[model samples]
Structures are given as structure tokens and as C-alpha cells.
Target: MTGQLTVTVGKSDGRVTVLTLSGELDRDETHLLEEAGEAALASGIQLLVLDLRSVTFCDSSGLRTFVHLHRLATARGACLRLAELHPPVSTVVEVVNLDRMLSLHPTVADALIL
Candidate 1:
């Protein structure tokens, strides 16, 4: 299947920036995530949440992108967390032990609470 990724940015209470990602996340699409995250941080958003509920699949390169995004958030004194991970993506995260490395929540609401 051809790879696709969509990133939608929104905010809650003007503080938390939510980035909703859907479709397959792969090496070719990592730039989208980085660009969105950079835009959020550049706009002075301290709280960033990555909503992955709609993501159908994620490759190892996608995981690397997440790590880079996480670093970008931290470098600017911001927070980056994952929420509502798809089952297959969740399994990959678990298998790679990213569950322990990244802040993960079951839903966007839960992530907003962080």
C-alpha cells in the first residue's frame, strides 16, 4: 500500500497543542511530524500531544521520528506525549520499549491532563 500521513493541529484551552496523525507513518512521512511539532513549538506551545488513534501503521523509522519530535519539544522547554495509539502501533512501541521512554496516554483527553 502507498504510505500516507496526515497531521492536523488544534488547541485546547489555548495551552495544549494537539497534533492528530492518521494513516501510515513511515520514513518518508517523518518530515510532516517534525514540521508540525516545530511549528507548535515555534508558536510557543508548551504542551504538545500527538494523537495517534487514527494511525493505521507505524514503521521503525516512524519511531525514530517520534524520538526526534520528543527531543525538539524538550529542547524548547516544552512537553511532547503520545495518545490513543493504534493497537499495531502500540505493539511496536511496546516491542521497542518506547512505552517506557515516551509519555503515553490512552486518549487525547488523558494526554491533555498531563
Candidate 2:
């Protein structure tokens, strides 16, 4: 069975916005994230942080969504950061070397500050 994905808008301060995600991220759920990302960009956010601490699983589709968001943010002159990645998500990221291409932080606080 596939897990349900939930995307919640956490905090928004000035130009920064946080989207907290939980559950599995796969091909079927990528659209949820993409929609949220587009909305953040449209709102004129300077930084978009994804708090992924609760994300239990992530596959290649999830990785692709990350890259898509990164590109979208870049085109809009916004920054995209991932924070508190769970082990499974981290492993997929490392395997694909996405860690080098995307901004990753140990926590949302770190992602916000640096």
C-alpha cells in the first residue's frame, strides 16, 4: 500500500516560508509538493525551506521533485533548502549525489540561519 503525503505550511516570516512534509514521497505524491512550492514562489518568498524530518520514505520521484523545486526557486530568485531529512530520504539523496546540488541542513533552524 502507498502512504499518504501531507504538506503543511509551517511558518512564514517576511520573505521566508516553511513547508513541513510527512509520510512517504513517491511519484503519486509529488504533485502535492509541487503545488505547495509553486504557491510559495508565487507569494514572493525569498527562501523556501522544506522541513522533511517526518518524511519516512522517499524514492527517485521524490528526488526529481526536489530538483524540480530547486529549478523553480532559482527561476524565481528564491532559495530552496531541505531540513531534518529522515534516514531513508537521506540515503536516497546521498546515493544520487543530490546533497551536493541542493541545500541541506541538520535542522530547520540551521537552514533558516545558514
Error of 2 at 49 (Å): 0.3
* TM-score attained by model 1: 0.91
Best by TM-score: 2
Per-model TM-score versus the true fold: 0.91, 0.96
lDDT by residue for model 1 (65-102), tens: 88988888899888999999978999999999998889
**Cα RMSD to the true fold for all candidates:** 1.5, 1.1
The total number of steric clashes, by the backbone 3 Å criterion, in model 2 comes to 0
Candidate 2 runs further than 4 Å off: none
lDDT of 2 by residue, 1-114 (tens): 278999999998769999999999998898899999889888999999999999998988889999999999999999999999969999989999999999999999999983
What value does the lDDT take at residue 51 in candidate 1?
Answer: 94
What local lDDT does model 2 show for residue 51?
99
For residue 2, model 2's alpha carbon misses the true position, in angstroms, by 1.5
Residue pairs that clash (backbone atoms under 3 angstroms), model 1? none
